[model samples]
Target: MILAETLLFALALIDCGAILFLLIYYIITLSDLECDYLNAQECCEKLNYWLLPKYIAHSFITFLLLFHGQILLFMLNLPMFIWTTFEYFTVPRGNLGAYDPTEINNRGQLKKHLRDVMIYIGYYLIFFFIYLYSFILALLKGDPIRRGSDDDIVTEI
Candidate 1:
């Protein structure tokens, strides 16, 4: 139980930190996106839908952990694992907020979009295991094990 909880907490914190970084990166990219083929509005909407929710969901899960909301934690994490599974396949198809495929007319553009999709998906995929481990720990724990423990939490300067 201790090891599992330790791993769960560590990974969850790491994932949340990485998510914050990603949110910043996505915001920078959205503003800096070349507006030749992709509409900036569309890119913003995609960020709102995809990247923003990731930040929210990850943060909410961390809150759930801090307060020891086991049931809610399990519930929220289950769907995310499932969603990540699907994203593993769909992301390669320009389905990950890259411009629509039909919009790309030439080979160079197609390659560039594919490379973009791969980079986004590749970096993001590392966190899927964190989510997976969390879901499993929450499921197995079945109740709050760390409900009263605040000793492990670290405060920044």
Candidate 2:
């Protein structure tokens, strides 16, 4: 059980680390105030490539959590899941309509943004529930209770 707990903690740490890294990367991408239309497209493409490793890491962590039944491991996996879901929706993808802006005007852009927002929000909700379910299961198991205590039991007269 101790070994299992340690492994679960390690996996969770890795998972959280990956999420922090990805969050930093996203922040860096957004920090560039000069990011324009083309820049946004390029950033999105680059992000897509970068996300592959993160996806794999997340999947691996989830696998460990499920197989090991480590609540800590599942807890570690939750942030990455949430962040990725958020990223998927918020990351700007080019317009779905014709590449040319002339064909798709303000209304089209608004619609596209709305669609992306909805998709992201929906997915986030789904993943959130999944994480919550796993977390609750883990919590129910409770932490490994320590075996020994030094306290003395006294009888009152």
Candidate 3:
């Protein structure tokens, strides 16, 4: 249990860290005028480069959770893994014409918007369920096991 807890904690930390890094990168990219000036092909290449590490980190977290023998964590991780994988596949990449951003009124733009909405819904639903489950587990189990804690103690004076 201790080992599993430690591994989960580490995975959680990695996931959280990767999330922060991605957020920061996203903010930086959005803040830059150079990004807007870049051609569609260049932008896609740059974006993919930024996304690759985040994909790896998310995958690692999911793998850890799946193998850790905890039912709740495993359930929580599976959807997240799938969502990220979906995003990776759906995301526009390289110099392909598929990636060119059209006007909001265009049919392609509407399709993209719908896809984004569905992905957001899926991600959020999974996240909410994971939190609810974890909260219930915490209530039932008191707290997760920690390393180097005294599980058994005897004192005599």
Alpha carbon lDDT of each predicted model:
0.53, 0.51, 0.53
List candidate 1 stretches off by more than 4 Å.
2-4, 34-71, 91-157
TM-score between candidate 1 and the true structure: 0.36
So what's the TM-score on candidate 2?
A: 0.44
lDDT string for model 3 (33-117, tens) is 2336544345444545756676677677667665666667667667767866786677455433323333332465534544554
lDDT of 1 by residue, 2-73 (tens): 245656566675675566566565545544555344564555455436644564555555455545545565
Ten contiguous residues with the weakest lDDT in model 2 = 96-105
**Greater-lDDT candidate between 1 and 2:** 1
List of clashing residue pairs for candidate 2 = none
Taking every candidate in turn, the Cα RMSD to the unseen true structure, in Å, is 12.7, 8.9, 7.1
On the 0 to 100 scale, the lDDT of residue 149 in model 3 is 48
Model 2, C-alpha of 74: deviation from truth (Å): 3.8
Stretches off by above 4 angstroms in model 3 are 1-4, 31-41, 90-157
